[model samples]
Target chain A: MSLQDILTTGTAPKRVAAGMGFWKSLFSALDTPVAAPSSVPADDPLAGYGPQAVEITPAIAANQRLILSTRRDIDLQELEALCDAVGWSRRPVRKVRRALDNSFLVVSLWEQLAQQRRLIGFARATSDHAFNATIWDVVINPSFQGQGLGRVLMEYVIAQLQQAEIPNITLFADPHVVDFYRRLGFVLDPEGIKGMFWYPS
Target chain B: MSLQDILTTGTAPKRVAAGMGFWKSLFSALDTPVAAPSSVPADDPLAGYGPQAVEITPAIAANQRLILSTRRDIDLQELEALCDAVGWSRRPVRKVRRALDNSFLVVSLWEQLAQQRRLIGFARATSDHAFNATIWDVVINPSFQGQGLGRVLMEYVIAQLQQAEIPNITLFADPHVVDFYRRLGFVLDPEGIKGMFWYPS
Candidate 1:
């Protein structure tokens, strides 16, 4: 297929299904080339769209449970609210949704009340899954700042990547937070690895 | 599932399959949820494996067509050899393979000869597929370095991402190539976006 066809129609060429096929193929490739299950079992949770959330339980506050989830089907409204609480510029919900879907890994943090759960922080990473991963959109709700939820979020994300055997983990920080990342053992442009970006004209 | 289960078993909870399911779910989430087709139709290119490559036809040299493919099933040996040609440290083939499988986008460049295609240059990006993308492992074979194939590869990768509507693109480069990326409109920490990384202790 022509490059134009890819851009215009968004018809990914053969084997290029970005979501389900992509993830399954990756796992299969990681372990071995497994045959596609002739059919997903009727009771399999994975039979549905997104995988189930894996909640990370860590004590964050008294009388409240702090939890983190790898849920990709995050509620867009809750995420937007978290971003708003941090005073970040508003991004279109549609685009935000697309970003989450495209992300290799997404970690969402929440404060669980007696009856409800609130999204208090969010982070994501995209990776080549071999050499490097770059994280983006790390934010904690203003009310939850200074409680160390941000640190907890980052640590969990980093641990997960490391466990998966990903070698390098990176994130772009604002001037104010450069020291914060450093305290977490993140060195800036370590060994002279300079960061670069490209913006649309 | 408990975080321990996630770490130990690697059985991603509900929707966490990193390969096919992850990708399909993301796409469905991006557009709108669609019913999983009951069964794969025979002859569907996507039904079996990775997507086909899309060729960009711009002349790099006469007779020897410089081709870029989005095809993810790249030969790890060729990639390792290209890295060797450029004097990069050796990486395990398995890890390199996983990295490509996990990447959001992978661009492999080839020099088409009368007899066969030779792997010449390579680059990949990991993206949230919405807000940001980070380019990685950008390299050109020493034999092909001066002809500007590296620039062509970066431009095409950036353009595809921009067309997909992602807002930010990033990469970490050695000091030597920082200026090369700048000429392509990438700035160093534009507006104070400092890049940071964490390595295993």
Candidate 2:
């Protein structure tokens, strides 16, 4: 069920079968041990996301909603499609796979259509548990962007970092979106405390 | 024999027996797949590290020579001693062990003293073989700090990252050492492109 459906119906998500051990280590390494919330508030902003709702055959409507997950069960095809959709400088699939598996926290969004969960929005973070955390690859399918899902996805990331008690959340944004992040309460690094980075050939 | 001794003798240091499989994955995950350097330039900067030399009894001189290694065989005692010597925030030994084992690249330095090698310097890095890499914990024992060991250690790291063809090398520097990095060719993030980060609590 979609996170919204569960929030609305006061039910829990169907837990996916995976070793909780990996999650435990990931959270521990990131400095915040977490248990997914038992239930979110009824009026949660997240619960309001049937935004682009369309009346379809009842059978299809039941399955075609945005599902949000905090797991690493990404499918290769779906991941590549998302990468292509965002034009992420083509990389070998294995390279992307290793990067995904190594991330400290990953929030994946899927939209069910034709009984298949097609990846839609994806964001991953790397953290040192106690000190530094960075947000990377915050992308939503262009078709889904303005429906408020981008904000929905980013808000989920910020909230998770906050809950983890991670004090530092850093991301480099394309110049066009500086204000978008400013609205989320991030400011430029302190004056003279600029960023420096080198890139590979 | 120490790295310096190998340099002096113009012979390859004996490769340690360990899981090549793990190093294979670590390097693949960090960036490019690499083979050990085929040769060293006769005028290599690493060779000049022995420039500060003193004549003493063979017994006394043996205790002061610099040693370097790119292996993961460091024991808990040496790691702990190095951490204590640097006055780092104390952490459980297991936590430090986990971090060390997870590093993408680690360059460690020791001083051959009597029959034991005392940890004197270390730097580790994390990277996505494609885009960004960060240098962290570039530390040297205070006793060895002023004699250019830190420079030797960091130069080794830079050369490795350069060989990996990693595009972006980033590090957060202490205010006092900004010029040290500045001399190494890093510049402030371009204007309007400042860095933003949150600290872990």
Interface RMSD values for all candidates: 7.6, 5.0
Q: C-alpha displacement of A170 in model 2, angstroms?
A: 3.6
DockQ of each: 0.32, 0.23
Per-residue C-alpha lDDT of model 2 across residues B83-166, encoded as one tens digit per residue = 789788676766566656665667787666545556778887766554556676778888765544565566557656765555
lDDT of 2: 0.55
Give the lowest summed-lDDT range of ten residues in model 1 chain A.
Answer: A21-30
Worst 10 residues of 2 chain B by lDDT: B20-29
Model 1: per-residue Cα lDDT over B1-201, one tens digit each: 432233335333222111211111101111223224456466322232223232334344556555566678888888889999989999888887777777778888777755467889898887776777788888989877765667666765775575466677888878899888887778998888777888654
Error (Å) of candidate 1 at residue A4 is 48
Q: Model 1 residue B101 lDDT? A: 76
The lDDT values for all models are 0.65, 0.55
